[model samples]
Target chain A: MIVDEVDKQIILATQAGLPLVAQPYQAIAAQLDLTAEEVMQRMRIMQENGIIRRVGAVPNHYKLGYRYNGMTVWDVVDEQIDYLGQLIGQLDFVSHCYHRPRHLPEWPYNLFAMVHSKTKTGVTEKVNIISQELGEFNRQQEVLYSTRILKKTGLRIGR
Target chain B: MLSDFYMQLLNDYQQDFPLTPRPYLAIAESLGVSEDDVLLAMQELTDQTLINRIGTIIKPNKMGKSMLVAMAVPEAQLQRVAGIVSSFSEVNHNYERENRFNLWFVLMSSTGELLQDTLDEIEQQCGYSTMRLPLVADYFINLGFELDLERDQELDREPDNGCDRLSTN
Candidate 1:
């Protein structure tokens, strides 16, 4: 997925959002001086390559009343991580699940799943369900709740 | 309150939004509604700030390198340190969490060298050591969140859990 200058331009132009119009691609094409077909073709290719994960509305979890967001981290059996992680990731409430290196004594958890809900109790319930799913493999777990959003400008590539 | 039509629009079109000349029209046809109706609902959603944007979600580290960095700033200096960290274009999604490592942020750059440079710069500016956690593997498929709109309505009736006050900060 080698994105050229034109592709970069397209990403820059639409990363914030597609134009709210009848012909959004045409609007993007006009801005980049490329044809609508070119924009569509490039975007389709990018989607195929997994460069563009999806093309749609990004809902604001907080605004949608999903006020409680918990980063639930777990220390699972090393050999069973991939299998356990896949199971956790498939849960509808788990938005972003990943395996990251632990920082020794301070951070013993390697598996992280971000759970969201309308209430704190709801968040805990979701965590409980995940714990049941992990079962014997789940060694230890902790949830970190974000207290404040300092910055949230998503993926900006400078021109 | 979100109408049934709005819920359908949000849930089904989180991924695989049309790439045609008239995407809204395509959506309307599939949903069995007029194009104008779909456009109006989308506009309403945007106006309410429910949806951040209708656009492409770029895969992480596909175009460049990125890492999740955390810092334990003293409470008094958290705001100042966060301001300095957020000033960098490379730093996105800075947050204050309920932990010893209070400040967490994601930093991204076009190259590996650049990413390291930005991290070093943040530590130097903030006068705090950072714990860098890079992704080892991603387990989740990148499909967008599926909104259970009806469940949200039901939950709205439940009593508060005393955590809603934290949002004021």
Candidate 2:
């Protein structure tokens, strides 16, 4: 999105993650040859424009004692999928929910909800809650549990 | 025992992480602790893998194009397929799941149109069918985990499910 020199620098610096320090912006400012205030101001603008989503900790669910996690997909009516998605997203257990295109007869689920819990029972109960939530519109659904994590890492932005 | 300050760092800052230059100092002031302590705990949390990282989650479709891709690799070819998929820098995350379409990976590209060609090449290279599930709309997307310290002392508390749309705040 028209990333200027400063914006580009900021993304690269924090892409890995803002360092765990007291003055992270100051640290970035020192590297970019700008004052801490300017760096903070620019990032505020970026956040306002939706460029920087949120500045916070991204925890590894696998390390958090959340042993059981499943991605539940639903084939809901296309017309009402958005409305249904919002309702599903609000559920406490549904960490990440999205409306994605389905491939066809082979892949029919359009709504994806990432459900996480400490145990299988927790996941099952949450799935039941979601099913009840989408009772009428739920056509077909499936939960794909991860058998192995081949790779897990954050998105790398500019450089 | 999970320190009160640590729990506060997770619960309070998950959402409006301070936009100031000295956020840890700000947090320290509020939590009645030293700035170094706040920084140390946050660093410790990250070092121990409790938190993946402390960073900005860029909004989707803002910088580049990404698609959720799945491949049905016969058990025999799963490893080979994974190696091929992982070799591509565009793939940020890949996983093996319990399903006929077992190998799932997210492929990202700087240019949006390149997505198809890359997927096509991967399919041709691996001789497997790859399904593309591009994101359409995000409802609630929060990637942060609150650690939920209260649950230990208070069993009656309901699980707090606070999710923002994945990439967007």
Candidate 3:
């Protein structure tokens, strides 16, 4: 789709990220010589067009005191993946759950779920619950605890 | 140019970031301003490149397939690898990390095979072996950005998953 110059400018500015201010839109308005309403309208359009999925704050999981966060990989049966994933996702503790290629020789887990709890034992408990709930589809599982934390940034796109 | 009012507004976002259709009105009321003013400010911040996009923090599994892919792309051909990976519609976010298994990106697709095919295509196109580290479990803490600014807390790897699990609305 053909984006006008104003839309282009808004996209470019937000590529870096939205400013953290009470009137952040005002800051952008001054930069673009447009009204804050205009900038918002354009963003709404971009979001509607799938150019941007969301504009929001990403929470930091570590700082809030709860310490046990681990990635749980499961080798679930193919046919039951959809139903099993929905069931695993229903557990509030499972923050992220999805299916990726097992990549046999390289990677062996087909379905991955993130479990967070107050302790490693808690995470393991949740994993066990998921495993039991998985029924016949559950084949194998592993938890890769993070060894280091990396910087997380929002998506940046060029128009 | 964020004013004191803007700072106050951000504070509100950090404290009680409401999850509602007209969330801005609540913020405006908290700041003693009109909802139009809050909306206008947010638009300006977005335009100026300060705050990231404001939207829902989806509790994973609600959407399509999401996987973490890593590749051992030669330094000489890093940009090419990134280009090839980014070309795929499934590749939503990509970045280079300081590790032996360097190139890291997130692939979100409706089908697992489709995600694998895209990665295989990237491997063939970029001449690098990509490692897929799809998450099996996820834990989230309520540490908003406000804490980051206040504390120069280093984002390091720690083995603790005591995070609150709430579908906050």
Candidate 4:
């Protein structure tokens, strides 16, 4: 899905956030000299093409009482990684799950799942649930809790 | 504690937010609330720093290339190294975690070449080798977090959840 110049403009305009108004699309269209219908159409097309994952209210997990977040990395059997990864990803507690490459001798975990909870105990409980689901296939695992958010500015694409 | 109305606004609108002309009105109609009420609630939520934004969550590697990179910084130089890394616009979500590879962040660029260049520059400035871990497969279908307001209410009653003191920032 190639994002043309117009699409790029739309992304830049709304990436920060859609305006808080009765007719947000119209406001964006006005900025770009595009019709409201065209703006909505382009966005819809982008959404269908997987360019736009979703358009919604992004909540701050920390402010929402999810203070404890652990990036739980697992060294699962390679053969069953996709199957197991899918299973682990579907859990309600897990937010971002991905199969990443492991730098052996230094890093040995390939599967990473970010678990968030209101309490540290809650995070451990969620990890335990994942462990049970993995069972014998779960060879080793470690949870890296973030102590400080050094920087957290969300993605910014410049023109 | 969040009101039930606000909870509904947060829970239901996390994903599949209206793409219509009057999205707020649509939400108001669906939630059986006045459009102004919905608008005010959303504004209040944004003001409270609860709602980061009402916008699109772009898929990684779609508009540009991105990868999660980690570097092990000495405790003494952690702050300095993190400052250098975060100085680059490409690097977002820099965090100091509890591990040997303490400094972790995600880097994104419009092109692969630019992404590599940023990574190289970070290593040079920070004086530490970085572990570039790009996503091979994403298993999670992001449906947004399901907030359990009831559980949160229960937790509010507890004496200490370790994070009693909120940062003013």
Top candidate on TM-score is 4
Q: Give lDDT tens digits, candidate 1, residues A9-73.
A: 88878778898899999999999999999999999999898888888887766666788889889
Q: By TM-score, how accurate is candidate 2?
A: 0.89
lDDT of 4 at A120: 90
Task: Give a tens-digit lDDT track for model 2, residues B1-169.
Answer: 3567766776677656788878888878988889898888988778666566777777776677888899888898899989998877778788888999998888777777787788888888888888888889988545454454543442222332321112322
Clashing pairs in 4: none
Q: Which of candidates 1 and 2 reaches a greater lDDT? A: 1
Predicted complexes: DockQ each:
0.58, 0.53, 0.10, 0.59
- In model 1 chain B, the worst 10-residue window by lDDT is B160-169
Model 4 TM-score is 0.92
Listed in order, each prediction's TM-score against the native is: 0.90, 0.89, 0.52, 0.92
User: In model 2, where do residues sit more than 4 Å from their true spots?
Assistant: A157-159, B141-146, B150-169
**CA lDDT scores, all candidates in order:** 0.82, 0.77, 0.60, 0.83
**lDDT by residue for model 3 (B1-169), tens:** 3366755554346433443335577677877898889878777645543444454343342334556887766777777777787777666666564445556677666567766777787788887787867664343333343321223333344543323221121
**Backbone steric clashes in candidate 4, count:** 0
* Candidate 1 lDDT tens digits, B72-154: 88999998999999999888678888998888888778887888888888889989989989998888576567766663353
In candidate 1, position B115 carries an lDDT of 89
Better of 1 and 2 by TM-score: 1
- Tens-digit lDDT track for model 4 on B36-127? 99999999889877788898877778667888999998899999999999888887678888999999888778888888888888899889
Residue A57 CA displacement from its true place in model 4, Å: 1.0
